[model samples]
Target: MKTNIKILALFLICSISAFAQSSKDAETVLQLSKDKWQWMADKNVDKLKDLFDAKAKFVHMSGTWKTDEELEIIKTGSIWYKEAKVHDSAIEVSGKTAIVWNRITLIAMVRGNEAKTEFTVTEVYQKQKKDWKMLALTFSSVRDTHQIKK
Candidate 1:
């Protein structure tokens, strides 16, 4: 009975430690997301590419899906960010796979025009070998003017 109890205690400890590590990793990725936005604002396309998985997919709110190269164009100075703020976010992990949900507001320069937008973004990250890479992202945007007044 004592041996069984010890084994159970060890299992619990290992489980808790894993949960803590996963949360920490998720937080790091979340912060990375913010940093990636900053990189985009600066038009650092090379760095942006590093942030994505080689097989990454990005889905725009308008139902347009893009490859990593296509997404990098935005980071290459095609658009500029006047304001971008991450609102709410959550993470779920299973083994090497992590799914992150992030809510954000963005004011950007697009096609020589300025626009403010809100979005709910879901990103899937995979642990590739020794590093985490963003594999897929899907987001739906809400026009700022259409949002309810608080």
Candidate 2:
């Protein structure tokens, strides 16, 4: 009976430790996603390049493109991401992949014109060699009142 109790206690401790680690990973990915928005607004392609996977894809209302094209657009100010005011966000982490959904008011300069729009942005990130790389980003136009279900 005592041995059984010891085994149960050990199992619970291990389970709790795993949960804590998962929570920490989720928070880290969440912060990375938020930083990405700021990097886009600042046009910090250096940081973005490191964060984006080589085969990363981006989907915008205007069109869809790959990593190099997206970086070029940002570098040339073709579509300057001025600001993203995130209203709500949720993240799910499964194994090495994390998906984040953010509802935001994005102010951008597109083709020399300023536009503000509400969108739900979905970002997918994968852990590779101790670093998280953004694999995909998709923007969907939505109403201001749209909420991200937790």
Candidate 3:
């Protein structure tokens, strides 16, 4: 009976440790996603370039594009991200991959015109080496009241 109790206690400790690590990873990814929005608004392509994976894909209402094209769009002011007001966000971390969902109201300048839209943005990140790199970003139009299920 004592041996069984010890085994159970050890198992609980290991499970708690794993859960704590996953929670930490989720928070890290969430912060990264928030920083990415600010970088986009500032048109800081240098920081974005490092965060985006080499083959990263971005999906927008207008069209879909790859990392280089997306960077070029931001750099050239084709689609200037003015601000992203994040209403809600949720992050899930599993092993080396993390997925974040954010409901945001984005104000942007598109082709010389200012536009505001509500969207749910899904971002996927993968741990590469010691850093996390964004692999995919997709924006879906949604109602202002849309909520991310926790």
Candidate 4:
């Protein structure tokens, strides 16, 4: 019937719209990941605290820490990020979960020692009540590909 055909067409349109919306959301999450790095570099613990989930876990070359502990470290400048240069990044979203990957060159002060290193960072964020909060983060050291040729 023509009515049945019309209903099917409308359903297809709605499905496509939903898919586009999800794609847009994924892009937003990727940008948020970049913003997070900027926040860390600036040592904006207040903003970082708002973005991190209460049950979040952070892992680095040194060790792992919970959300509150990580926030405290940032606030006190124990391991302060001075700069982060992102070399490459990607993001994927599945329902309310998003995973972001970034290859970055980071300069930071770790326990009063200035160190610069390259790392591949993975961040997992979950959508919580219309906002995305970071749930977990892990980083692995990488070779510096950003070195200038003399």
Which candidate leads the pack in TM-score?
Answer: 3
Give the TM-score comparing model 1 with the true structure, all chains together: 0.83
Models ranked on lDDT: 3, 2, 4, 1
lDDT score, candidate 1, position 138: 77
What's the alpha carbon RMSD for model 3? 1.0
Evaluated with lDDT, which candidate comes out highest?
A: 3
Best-to-worst TM-score order: 3, 2, 4, 1
By TM-score, the better pick of 2 and 4 is 2
Write candidate 3's Cα lDDT for 1-150 as tens digits. Answer: 999999999999999999998998888899999999999999999999999999999999999999999999999999999999999999889899999999999999999999999999999999998899999999999999999999
Query: lDDT for model 2, on a 0 to 1 scale?
Result: 0.95
For candidate 1, write residues 81-121 as lDDT tens digits: 66668776777778888887777797788768887889877
Q: Runs in model 2 with CA error above 4 Å?
A: none
lDDT of 3 at 2: 100
Superposed on all Cα atoms, the candidates' RMSDs to the truth, in angstroms, are 3.7, 1.1, 1.0, 4.3
Query: Against the unseen true structure, what C-alpha lDDT does each candidate score?
Result: 0.74, 0.95, 0.97, 0.89
Poorest stretch of ten by lDDT in candidate 1: 141-150
lDDT of 2 by residue, 5-91 (tens): 999999999989988977988999999999999999999999999999999999999899999999999989999999999999999
For candidate 2, list the clashing residue pairs, or say none.
none
